[model samples]
Target: MKSYDDKHIKNIVLVGAPKSGKTTLSETMLFEAGIISKRGTIEEKNTVSDYHEIELERGNSVYATLLHTEWKDYKINIIDTPGLEDFIGEVIAAIRVADTAVVLLNAQYGVEVSTEILWEYIDRYRKPTILAVNQLDTELASFTKAVEDARRAFGNNVTLMQYPVNQGPGFNAIIDLLKMTMYRFPKDGGKPEKLPIPEEEREKAEQLHNELVEKAAENDDTLMELYFEKGSLDEDELREGIQKGMLQHQVFPVFCLSARNNMGSGRLMGFIDNVAPAAIDVPAEHTADGKEVAIDPAGPTGIFVFKTLVEPHIGRLSFFKVIAGEVKAGMELTNFANNTTERISQLFIADGKNRNTADRLRAGDIGCTLKLKNTRTNDTLGDKHFPGPIAALEFPSPKVRVAVEPQNKGDDEKLSEVLAEIHLEDPTLLVEFNRELKQVILHGQGELHLLVTKWRLENIYKMPVVFLPARIPYRETIQKPAQASYRHKKQSGGAGQFGEVYLAIEPWYDGMPPYKDHPVRDSEEITLSWGGKLVFNNCIVGGAIDSRFLPAILKGVMEKMQEGPLTGSYVRDIRVSVYDGKMHPVDSNEISFKIAGMMAFRDAFHQAAPQLLEPVYDLEATAPDTMMGDIMSELQSHRSIITGMDAANGNQVIKARIPQAEIDKLFAALRNVTQGKAKIKAEFADYAPVPADLQKKLSENYKETVAV
Candidate 1:
């Protein structure tokens, strides 16, 4: 394969719902551009984009695939991303560096849940987008309906640039309404033949052509006048206006094609060459210093690492987008986030598993770097004096949880080091150490995401790890006030020890929930002053306890709080006052006061209304109204309460609150009931008191387990 420089770069991300032929389109484009000898098919399991073993076995894309091909003197970097929600992170990473997104829609299905989600992301980024309605030759294909669906989902800005001439079994050609030309292709891949519009389709083509001209004219005053006066517009003027409209997001042009037959692939390429934004045409990106930098082939080098892949044979491969100047092999660039310099080597443009080396990369291009020590996904690389990080795409938090442990006894040390590196590669994969639970928990978007991490552990790091259901982190608190006192005495040593401490525990009734506001912070000490008038006055004029032992008594109270009275869980929010204490002048020391404080806390907590606080999760679920009954019933089974329900895109969104432990397997349940059509997002909410019966059972269960 021949390599190209960045001057002719165009980065485009292919996105859509599952079974939308995104991979087929990539294969057709590669074959037509002479980048490949024969097109690979998804059914044959030889497609370049879905080349991963897991993908081939599943017959669906599980990650994003990078492919580079040359067409019309332009080097196009195409990213094929997974359509399933489980792998939406891959789609997010692709859009981070892309200048444009082409959303593919299955002709029969129109626009589905995944397509709408991808479009939302594109809108969030304000990136230029095009809609490609695929499977035009299928028996259920309907170009008019597909266009209408796009308009309904994305508003009236959706405009058609081309239309298929015929339906299934008779599909043979596509007509460019704007260019007023028809491109016909044979079954096999080859150059398309430009011909006059078919006689039968001429009337429809003219109507579409008139609509296109009017839209283009609306964007250009001169074209509007010319169009009004002459009833038509010149080709150049129409093209320029459409290009401007596309750049400004005023119009989203839709195209139709059969990717398997390679039909309309060349015309699609022609549109990309004419309508897609060049490096210099893209809006200037702002740096961290608030300085605007132009995206030009000759500008200073600024590379944004959008994605990182850990291959068993290749080590770490980072895919980066050239946002500013140029990058060459062996050059050094500073990481803006960490302020560390890294040497670049062996730059290559990848097409799935295959790669072609490039001498240098310029603005608006995507390429790969091998073996960087500190550079990671989302890290920006540029000159040290003006280093800047690219704005990261907003990714949803990992909602699923699993606990992982190294299989080998000694592998624990290596497991942590390897997982840390893995987390660096994909920030979406979170590895957290639950100090209270004493578990290494791994969280990701879904079950497959966690499974892929385990696969990486075994294949890349040569470490076997066992995964188990993660335990929910729970807390203990009190509901009423109680006071207790205890004394400690010992005379075995030369210096006898004697000390006594008094403490009081009370229920926390502050308006705001404690841990919900500060999810991860440790328990903090809160001091209350009651006018500082010896709040714990003994009223004993004859000093019963030595004043010097006061500090030791207070220290003991702190130790008791740390070792919770009920379940060893950290106690929080209750107030403790070391009011009155008696200490022996000769025997009293720190140890004696500490023991006294421990006993006092244990006695006081039982007097207080101690209870277990279980965590709740805020859930938002979207499902069709017909399926709402099923979903609500399912939620009820999980001990969930619906707070609100609303309408969205022909679906009912159920906003509910449920316990975290109750919905541990919600993903599987949701998929089963909705047939993988439901969408759900959840976050940690406030904690509520567990019922008396359940609390008693939990406490006893915990004690039994501890004893074991």
Candidate 2:
């Protein structure tokens, strides 16, 4: 292993939809670079990138894998990412640290749902990208149609650099527009022989070549002027122009390849090594506080941990990118997130499952360190004198939730520890312990996401678990005002308990209540643990009830609020006035007054009209115009109120408010209805009253559970 300067390092990530041949492409690239003797197929489960047991069983990539190869004096680091939407965290992390993204498109299907979804992230990061049309040897492959689809989805910036000559089962040659030559591979598919363009195809090739030159010239003012004077650019000038155009996002070159047969990959690798921008060529990153952090090989050392993996027998493996200066073994750096110092014990460059020991990793290069004490994913480790920490990756919020419980009685503690370890590996898997609902909730992307998590827990951690539907946190509130009085009397042998409470309960709103007639002794506003407010006012006249007893009564009232009278849900938004009460000197203790206050509140709550309030979420669903009617109908069936509708990026944006109860498994249902073309985002809006029939059914169910 050799240490490469920043100019000689090229970091790139492969991204696309599932079954789009990303894994095969990476294997082909590795084989062509002589890193591997033979190409491994996904069906055989021997591909370098898909090495995990779960991935082998599923015949797809479940995690991101790092592989590097030396091509033409450049160390090209390739990050192969998962294409399934459930495992999108892997793709995002890879894109955050890579300099360029190579998005593969299946020629048969063209731009797909997953392709559109990944394009959003690529656009967000403003990455320089190259579109590779893969599976060109398949029966249904069509290069022309694929180009048309890319133009429609991505706009006019898509420029063609290569096109298939005879693209079917016998696909062997591709016309390279940049060099105005034909690369013809043999039937067995090894190195391609460069030849002049045939006479029949010369006219079309020349036209496309001129178009490429024009597109390249548009990227720089000097290039444009030189093109106007000379009417064309030389080969060297064209390569420089294309590189500038790619960095500015003015051109997205499209290349054709058949990854399964290992054809056209060498040309793509050559283009990447010669044209793609290096890590130091891209713009500088910024901190969360808007301070620029340059990628300087001479500056203070800084490393950003983008991914963490937990091996079977080994400890944690932290994958990081050197942002500034160099990292070597036995170097100490400050963890900016926790303000803790950690020592780098060993440095290695990853090649799928294999690792090569390296003496040092320079700036703008990716490598891994073993067993850092406190550093985790998204943490920044740098010199203590650095100004601030680097910006963290913004992950998508969880869309689906399920309540998980241990199969055995005493496995709760073990489950907690295992869940913490899982979170450390993948931060998107959220585990929340809801004390009010008495359940441990696991939130993830979708059903498959949670299913994979459950598999890991049972197989890796040896913990059997059951997943159930999560309970909705419904609330209870009063509708009107009512008055009640209760007297608690106990005649024990030694001491007796005697306390009476008279309280007025009313629905509280924004402004202060009217206590004009009575002089208020104590008044305080409290925020309920559930969702609303509780207003307590003490208007006792002439010490009817002692001032010290007021807090005890409030405490009892709060206890009742935790378990509402109707359905045992948390209660909120009510005002209680201890206007008058009676007490005994010896027996008027906290317990007596507490019981008295509890009884009186229950009596008054029954007198007033009680309502059940359920949580509502603001939902935004983006889908094509053809699916708008069906989506709106589906939302209406779930008791959703359509708030607004607008157009966004050629899709219809539907905004609505839907109840939390109705959103269970909604993501899976939407995927089925829209053919995986729709994306939904939801957040907590507010609490609204549940329908009368639903409220009655919920109350009856609660009572039955309590009785059992």
| Candidate with best TM-score | 2
How many pairs of residues collide in each model?
3, 0
Residue-level lDDT tens digits of model 2 in 340-364: 9999999989998899999899999
Best by lDDT: 2
Cα displacement (angstroms), candidate 1, residue 285, comes to: 1.7
Superposed Cα deviation of residue 283, candidate 2 (Å): 0.9
Candidates in order, TM-scores: namely 0.91, 0.95
Model 2 alpha-carbon drift over 4 Å, by segment: 385-387, 512-522, 626-630
C-alpha positional error of residue 631 in candidate 2 after TM-score superposition, expressed in Å: 3.4
lDDT of 1 by residue, 65-123 (tens): 99977898888889999988878888998976777788998889888766777787888
Alpha-carbon RMSD of each model: 4.9, 2.2
